[model samples]
Target: MKDTNKHQGLRNQLAKQLEEKGITDKNVLEAIKRIPRHLFLDSGFEDFAYQDKAFPIAAGQTISQPFTVAFQTQLLQVKKDDKILEIGTGSGYQTAVLVALGAKVYSVERQNELFKITSALLPKMGIRPKHLSFGDGYKGLPNYAPFDSIIVTAGAPIIPKPLMAQLKIGGRLVIPLGEGEQIMTMLIRKNETQFEKHEFGEFRFVPLLEDKN
Candidate 1:
């Protein structure tokens, strides 16, 4: 059985942080609360998993700060069992959160090491889904097109058109935009030829890169 106390404490901490930051989405807050953040990081840093800060993991990527995760996820407005395409699988933390929120997540990790580690870690955490892939996040998973939502974990110089095309009409895509420094961007497809874009705020994330693994 899972450790209820640790889970409760993490939930409380994340809830307080989200409230202080004005994250109003109850579903997002609860998703962050239920998932065990510690399980997503290196054992040495597990104690700090619930803190509102990023921590280094393999492949020179840092697990995103808790508040950022919650903020981006809140923007998605996920529904029960929605199919989600996650562009980056750093540490698999965000994927775990999506699964906890009842999403059927299909995650692609460009970093082979992270892909392997999380492939093993997620199942142990009871966050199993039918698909996990090691590939470039830019290409997306075309075979599973028309995802209910798409979340790009890394920063892109511009939104990749291919990834955008994968979204279902009325679907949401949350990605970090800009070249050097980045801003969290949300795009909702309005129709075959149109979308609505909103910029959140300045944020830091690893560059989205090409991969063939």
Candidate 2:
């Protein structure tokens, strides 16, 4: 399936709905409009791609709802060329949005199935992140520390300390913290030992997985 005018129109409607729901970032809205969300899902679910709801994808994960993607991205306040570390590649929909906003993204996917599929799919769609690693999200990418921002796509029981340490001073970390139902939380590194925290209500997400082997 290809991205047609109909898909674009549906995306426009979705963006409008998100704006009404309080997504005020123009860049985030535009990225929502521009990226072909349909292309990120299975062919059978392509018709539901532009809706403001999440849909099931490979590896028992769901492609995040469009509004959730926009909301998290809006909180990050992504700037062009910002070095962003994404904790879950999932369907690569969020990765595409970050790329559309001109961030050099380094994403990690614990599910090897998703990592392989998305790593290949993204380049085909011309959305190339700086790095895509199939590993535990808990450890993060220490080699590429000091990111401008970090986004955790899955819900975490607790904020991973490694992700917090990977941010540059004043960098933001947007994560959904909890088990069952998560409270969207944002942390801004203030100094060597201080981080300002803010919560943005609740959201449902697949659990952040760790490599046990």
Candidate 3:
């Protein structure tokens, strides 16, 4: 699974397309360009990897579309070595982007199969997360609380209380909210009790399941 020149070309094109789609964060776009998405995908889907579309991965989850990953990452406003808690580790693609942006990523996944696969795969790609846990995303990583920012890759019905508690006073939590059609929601923690909520347009994601696999 070597990253070829052709793969790099496709990634470059995908980055440009993302920029045109209103993803203004240069670091996010560059990170998107740097990571080889096709490597994270199964061989059958490798040809379509750079097409900016979501495709099925193992464990009943889908690798997120490139634009959607960029959108979530851009909203997080990551800085160098920002401690980011990622709710899902599907395909490890989003984690790779965050790592490429110099983030200290702490990722969680519910599916045991996906978790096992990604935990091994990320290290092979040099995208090792600070901590990779198999547990509920809603619970977050309590021991490593006070994260600089948190990004939930699945559509949560409601923002989990534990996640809010784990964020630093000024941290941001990016998540998609709702059932059938989700609305991208960003929560900026203004204080211990006050959070500023901003809603982006609707996007669909698999439900964020709690305490179940």
Q: Which stretches of candidate 3 lie over 4 Å from their true place?
A: none
Among all windows of ten consecutive residues in candidate 3, which has the lowest summed lDDT?
A: 204-213
TM-score list, all predictions: 0.94, 0.98, 0.98
How would you encode candidate 3's per-residue C-alpha lDDT over 1-213 as one tens digit per residue? 799999999999999999999999999999998999999899999999999899999999999999999999999999998999999988899999999999999999999999999999988887877889988888999999889999999998899999999999999999999998999999999998999999999998988999944
- In order, candidate lDDTs are 0.88, 0.94, 0.94
lDDT measured at residue 58 in model 3 versus the true structure, 0 to 100: 94
State model 3's lDDT. 0.94
The local lDDT score (0 to 100) that residue 125 gets in candidate 2 is 87
Clash pairs detected, candidate 1: none
